[model samples]
Target: MQAVHTAATAPAPRFALRSSELPIGVVAEQLGLTLRAIRHYEEMGLIACGRGPKNVRTLGQSARARLAAIADLKALGLPISEIADLLGPDGACPDRLKARLRAQLEALDARRSAIAGYLSGL
Candidate 1:
């Protein structure tokens, strides 16, 4: 079966895989991730993949969405732990996600201001 694209409202950018399963190399390429990074994320349990023929790691639709969310959240400065909580078994709570994101934005704002101030003094 061909993999279906995850809904836009599914919480993150979801790319499609030609088939129900895709090799690690293809996933890494499409997601702009490295094979090692993909493996690392798997090791961290941030996402899960399955074993395909020849034992190559294969990522399915759900797994792709999860990895995409992990990458997007990480880019936004969310740690893996927070991401796990956000995507936990109960699924995402809008309130919780908003609060955490708000905090991260505030922290980033402070850091940017500090850097600007430091640069001005130079």
Candidate 2:
């Protein structure tokens, strides 16, 4: 007796991301960053951009991530050199990265506790 084979099912369709080709103003607004700050990051090589025929800057996904990272690191009071080192490709890690982040969190918590203690005593 011969056995029958079953047909395979088709995969589901993927939803495409809808992002506009944004200018600097639009990007600044979307990222909640100032135009001057974005320019400074670009100048520091933290963010990359493509230049149009008229030298208009166009940012890509990597640039967006770098910009966000820079903003976060700045808010955490990290120096630019340290942020650049942290964002470097060779510096990306599976173990060391987590350790570094934990250290930063601890430091932030300690600072917060100190501030709270001072406020409580005031």
How many pairs collide in each candidate, listed in order?
0, 0
lDDT of 2 by residue, 43-75 (tens): 877777765435667676667766776777677
Question: Model 2: runs farther than 4 Å from truth?
Answer: 1-20, 90-97, 116-122
Off by over 4 Å in 1: 1-18, 90-94, 113-122
Worst 10 residues of 2 by lDDT: 12-21
- Return the clash pairs for model 1, or none: none
Best candidate, lDDT: 1
- What is the lDDT for 40 in model 1? 88
Query: Could you tell me how far off, in angstroms, the CA of residue 29 lies in candidate 2 after the best superposition?
Result: 1.4
Report per-prediction Cα RMSD to one decimal. Answer: 11.4, 12.5
- Candidate 1, residues 1-122, lDDT tens digits: the string is 97666685456424443478889898889888889989988897777888876678999888887787778888887877778777654334467788888888899999999999999999
